[model samples]
Target: MQTEPNSNPNGQDVLLPPDGDDVPRVQDLDLNLLKAFHAVYVEKNVGRAALRLGMTQPSVSHALSRLRLVFRDALFVRTPGGVEATPRAQRLAGSIDRVLRILQDMLDEGAQFCAATSRRVFRLHMSDFAESAFLPTLMRELDTRAPGVVIETHHIEDSQFNMAIESGRIDFALGHFPHASSHFHFSELLQERYVLLMARRVARRLELDEHFTLGLNAPDGLHFIAVTSHPQATELLERYGLTSRVRLAVPNFMVVPAILSRCDYALIVPHTVARAFSTPGDSAMFEIDDASTWPVNAYWHRRFDADPGHRWLRGLLMELFRIGAREPFDSWLGAPLDLAPDSAHNA
Candidate 1:
């Protein structure tokens, strides 16, 4: 049988000789071979990496053996849990992943995509705002169009946008982020004004009280629930002289609706988010006086600009959320594969 002499032989590793001028060059490695190297490096286990690459354990071991000889390093050493990368492998990880993304982009640039049958899993970094205002509609639309497709959402910090998109950790992000960036493309979805929300009972009490006026400002003596995810909430509180009146501070808006219902704490949120949480009959919403607005945006790295899948998803999102879009998003300019069988099976 053909074999890598230094690969696991008789189920045991065999160390290789020293590197020489005969070492394999980068061009000597094919895309699949480099993929094997990357999978093992990231997964830190041969069997698991093999599963990720859809190959047998022995095949992955053979590929690893070739990679070790090519790079002239042990690359990884066995650990009780899995494997630990050597310094060289650690250093190679970034460039290898970047190369893979670039090559995938190049391939997808000209590839025809059949969303009706494609079972691609897209990753997105969504803020709580997007989760509330965008996810439900986007998912419902996807369900009708691509039943086999899936979405995995990540909660990431604004600072991680560039690396997250470039590393393929996230395909798209929707949040309030600084627009000035050389590496990212930002599209504004909504630049909504700030509004306050409270339980319906509380609005009734405020309306009957003789203290407030039309287009009411925040009245004195009410506590506030501050969502840390929207820093503008805090800024608005400070602007309204209610900083010390903040009763509770939470990381996200997930529980704000419940809190508003159970307590008299006022919630300062973007008009879009407030719309999602506000009950027309049961919740009171007041437009607070301020030019201060929260901007929701979609961000992606420039490196993925040409990827067909990436472009398709981005265009779908833009059409789904942008204020004036009337049609279902479709970026596929060319004819799609005849995927009737696949669609029938997946459905």
Candidate 2:
């Protein structure tokens, strides 16, 4: 096994080959060059990877050439479109990932983690609805576990999300999954249902039952309002037979509770979101569309699938909800209502 050259100013002791490990001896190889290697392998583009490393394209090309000569193997092969990892490159990718993680830990040793004592900044992207629902509680848990850690959140609109995640502009995205591609590693964090929200005054005017009889009979003047922060809102409303009217359309879901609190405007949003936005003394859920539900998912590029920090945050979010990847509606919803129309409707 070849030993790569020591690039750390702290000397070779910084990253020693494992346990007299039988890895190749690359005493002449600059270990710092591996950073470039990892970036190229992950990005699959020399020019883009160089840009990521803040280096010129020619320098990245030269470093890659030197690596190929030292290893005596063609690590990557260029296709007509882009570069593809060769067999050796594939094997090296995992090792490189581990090495980079260790490098990060080394750089932050002064900020030694006791978990109980570590304070760090984590970034996440979420739609407005998710921000209202999970950010508060998630922050509370973080405050207890890692009090110094600050969570920075960015809004991911339906239009800008796909590009944002792919380009690594955001760490991870949280929301009901749109009709997305398989390139992302997405996990279902929680199951949530869409609920109809109305002012208490309006709900009281309609003497409704579990079937929402008076709600169906309410005058059209109530004027349905829909939050378009998510693409699903409109489709969900149409699915439940309310497509003709949209008296108000807002991009932010957090503003919804205020709007509903002041007017007879009825809005549709997830149950968890509705609960979070409801002011204790000011608002209430007028109706819940028990039938319409979707899994709230955490999405990240496959490039980050094995990243320790990213994985930890995703797991923490799941743990806070006391649910696993595919929790059912019953696990979260308080009461089950069968929205299926039966022979009573036929009569």
Candidate 3:
């Protein structure tokens, strides 16, 4: 049988003389591969490491091959049962384990956020109405500190709201929730109040009782051109005893002012949304103060609760919305800042 010299309690070889360059040095190795090596050691299988890395099995095999060359030994030997660590690998086990842990900690810390150097992409769900008021502020924040990060918005619809989030089709949805789903986690974002969008001249002439009679039955099926990215019109109509006789329905909110210019039609939207739709033109938005308030929320799949990327996005949103802060009543929406916890809950 082949035998090797044993080490003393002080980790010094007892049988061989000390060599000049025998000290362990990690500087020469590719530090990036440490994550892959750690995964392999923990799983004890190449296939699992590949899955964890979101790579192909062959790719993991190739990385392992490279690790062997760097370590100058077959770190793991295939036996009748499982891969076993060799003497050199055994000596490395402790140090490699610590190195892998430190690397993971660094990655986790980096993800925690340093706006100056971060380039994270945050996927958010919102309606065109919410986007009109919030996107500008969010963009300003992105350009300042989190300049490298980009936001991908998902417009939430009543038909697919539940499935889209539960199945991971999107990262998170921001809007009202009729009921909670088992597959998702919900956090309150803000309260949305209904409003009316009409020509300023028409707004002045219509009495409060006849406010619903702008040639539109309610909010959805109106005789005038309507530009809506979400179902806020339909929702607003449902709250009141009205129904819209929609003649035109466009998907973008930016087109509303143009559409409402020639036609004598109006749109019933959220107050914040109406503010966004307001411009120096023939049409403008008016708050429907009598309409019921809807609670808006941020929802995500339960499965993503533990993911690092998902958590990062969730935290960023909470910071942006200041979840407890009340919606601004000063009109044009305020700067993106934290809302006090006590006042954030009310609409």
Candidate 4:
């Protein structure tokens, strides 16, 4: 039996076998044709695409012709300004770009990473408390090791966190975020505990025995300053039954020190923030008994797991901050955390 040949949208006859198996064989296709199509789709002009691909105009045009034949469509239509992609071409652009990116990353894995010569910029998302605790040590290390590398930090909203990491807008997010999708890779950096900060006069006025046992119903004229918008802070307040005594609601941890210094209000803050704010004769810090310890982690997309530049940075962070043998509260001080041979995965 014989079958009629197929006709494309432009009325061009596409030759078919006797059995009507019209699909092109994958083994017979040249990968370079796809590269040419990608260049033209991005540049929107044949001449510019040729320039980008380091090929002559006729060569690029020939590749495009073969691509059109295989797809059975006019992928792009020429106009006075440039070329406009057809619906079919538009649909394929994203997948093509992703494939090319993966190929490039694979090639880069073989190259050696030289910190002195690399001018890479790393983007990170971190809360103000993490900034206060981590940035100083990180900066010192970068200045000595990777002098040319630049670090840019941004504040990420909860709604945009997953999208931002997937799209490569942010490289690493540092804090106590929940477990991410399998597409993301995360390692615990350290564990953090909460503490209470109060003014010097208040600390001196309250008896030590009574202060430790103070209940939510104790009318000792203590008004709590709460970070109601943050999940961790809100949960901590409610767990200790201090939500009813809240006299002021703030949005972040950075402003708590300034507010507490001027008023009699007390704040429950991360141990790092407590250390930063508790200067001599100003504010006093006290450990909250039986408070839960939260894990601080560093997150990156799985695409960058093997990248040389990213691996170097992640290693440095792990070496500097990973909690091993030191006490949780004392690790944030100038003392270095113990780095045992078997504890490499903590970072």
Off by over 4 Å in 4: 1-110, 209-219, 239-241, 335-347
> Candidate 2, residue 86: CA error in Å?
49
Report lDDT (Cα) of residue 31, candidate 2.
65
lDDT of 3 at 201: 46
What C-alpha lDDT values do all the predictions have? 0.72, 0.67, 0.61, 0.73
lDDT tens digits, residue span 1-347, model 2 = 55443222111222223234244566856766798899889888878888899998878877876666555555766765567777877998898889889988887764434556656577788767777767777877787887877788987666878778888778778877575558988878777777766665564455333356223444555567877756666776676567576788887776776778777777776767766765443444645444456778888888866665666676787676647644333344333323222234334
How would you encode candidate 1's per-residue C-alpha lDDT over 13-46 as one tens digit per residue? 6666665567567686888878988998888889
TM per candidate comes to 0.58, 0.56, 0.55, 0.60
Model 4, span 230-314: residue lDDT tens: 5666676787677888998888777877787788888787876676666555556565656778888889998888778888888
Listed per model in order, the count of residue pairs whose N, CA or C atoms clash below 3 Å is: 0, 10, 10, 0
List where candidate 2 sits over 4 angstroms from the true fold. 1-113, 157-163, 179-181, 213-221, 235-246, 280-282, 286-291, 322-347
Give the per-residue lDDT of model 3 (tens digit) for 68-124.
Answer: 555555566554444556677678778878987788898887456566677767667
Looking at model 4, report the run of 10 residues with the lowest lDDT sum. Answer: 337-346
Better of 1 and 2 by lDDT: 1
> Which residue pairs of candidate 2 clash?
1-23, 1-24, 1-25, 2-23, 2-24, 2-25, 2-26, 3-24, 3-25, 3-26
